[model samples]
Target: VNYILIDKFQEKFGSAIQNLSESSVISLELNGINISRFGKLCWLQVSTKETVYLFDILTLGYEAFDFGLRRILENEAILKVVHDCRFLSDCLYHQYKTSLANVFDTQIADVIVRKEEAGGKWPDKLRLLPECLSHHLGLPAAAFQKYSVSRQPLEQASATVWTMRPSHSALLHLAARHMPELLALRTVLLDKLMVPFTIHVGHSLDAYR
Candidate 1:
């Protein structure tokens, strides 16, 4: 299988009507944009003819997956957008989980919290941030804990995770390597809005629509 990896790219198009003018490869007719942020929407589309997927680093979710996997799952030409990217990634993780297969900072934070759960070189600014709220309210890391945890640089983990299941392992490492080490633990959604919800709460990602 061709393991395509794209980094720092977007798949945005103004509208189906507008994109139609570009190339048959480019179009705006999408199945639907499930969850989105920052003015970008994440959509999932499929065709019986083929399946397409895109691994652009900027946007690596359903849109790219649908487009890149087109040949495997469908034959119908895909209609994709290319605005900011990542719009779909935010939601796709929640929607597809395993099918979409991705990880991010929120996820790692949640994991470590269950263990250390708090305070390790976090930034003062993040302390009040809505996303990191829960983190602070909860017990800081582990006081009398026996296990060991270390907060490091994200760049450092990026190189290591690749050797062991790059995708999942890398993201796991990334979460631990957070910049401030800990987000202020602002909001409860840190778990809801992050990988935990996507990995545990969401439905079978294999059945992603």
Candidate 2:
């Protein structure tokens, strides 16, 4: 099946994908817009829960983030296996596969990602994670949120920026699923090398509840 990726803000802005004359080649114009993977990632980290809840209420007369519910599940079968809102909402509404299969994220606590990039300079530590939150919220290198972003209304802008941003992998993969370089990279970084990498995993709903 030909998968037509409908990328908007992050990439593939407006109208036609030209340059196929007797050849099945998709060539972008000289000024082709690359999707804002950074921005989308920011949004996902921020907007997803709200967006997914909107999806749940779709039958109650609300608009969903376009095509979001499809991302939640390719089919309903996956839904029956899990009941957590984060798992279901992230997978279907936002296209995340959160199986934690053969994963060591639960096991690692000592590893740390030192964020030394000059732009968002903060001493590298495990606590202030996922970059956007660390920098925007002025998280100390070793600081935890200390409070939830959603709990406080004042930090909502910061929340919105980081949460909705999509990863570069998703955008690139959408362009070409078989893109060897990225797949290899993801396999290594995401599926391998035992992470807690540079990102912090938040508490589970059970813990919070």
Top candidate, metric TM-score: 1
Q: How big is the positional error of residue 82 in model 2, measured in Å on the Cα after superposition?
A: 17
Q: Please write out the lDDT profile of model 1 over residues 37-149, one tens digit for every residue.
A: 32222222311112222233234445543444333222234323221224344444344431222123343444455443243443333222123433444544452121122
Alpha-carbon lDDT, every model: 0.31, 0.25
Q: TM-scores, in order shown?
A: 0.21, 0.20
Worst 10 residues of 2 by lDDT: 45-54
Worst 10 residues of 1 by lDDT: 45-54
What's the true lDDT of residue 68 in model 1?
A: 42
Model 1 has a clash total of 42
| lDDT of each residue in 1-209, candidate 2, tens digit only | 12233334222212111111111211110001111222222122101111111111112111223333222223322211111123223333333332212111211211212232233355444431223233333445443333233213323443332233242344322222212221122233333334333233434434657
Error of 1 at 167 (Å): 8.0
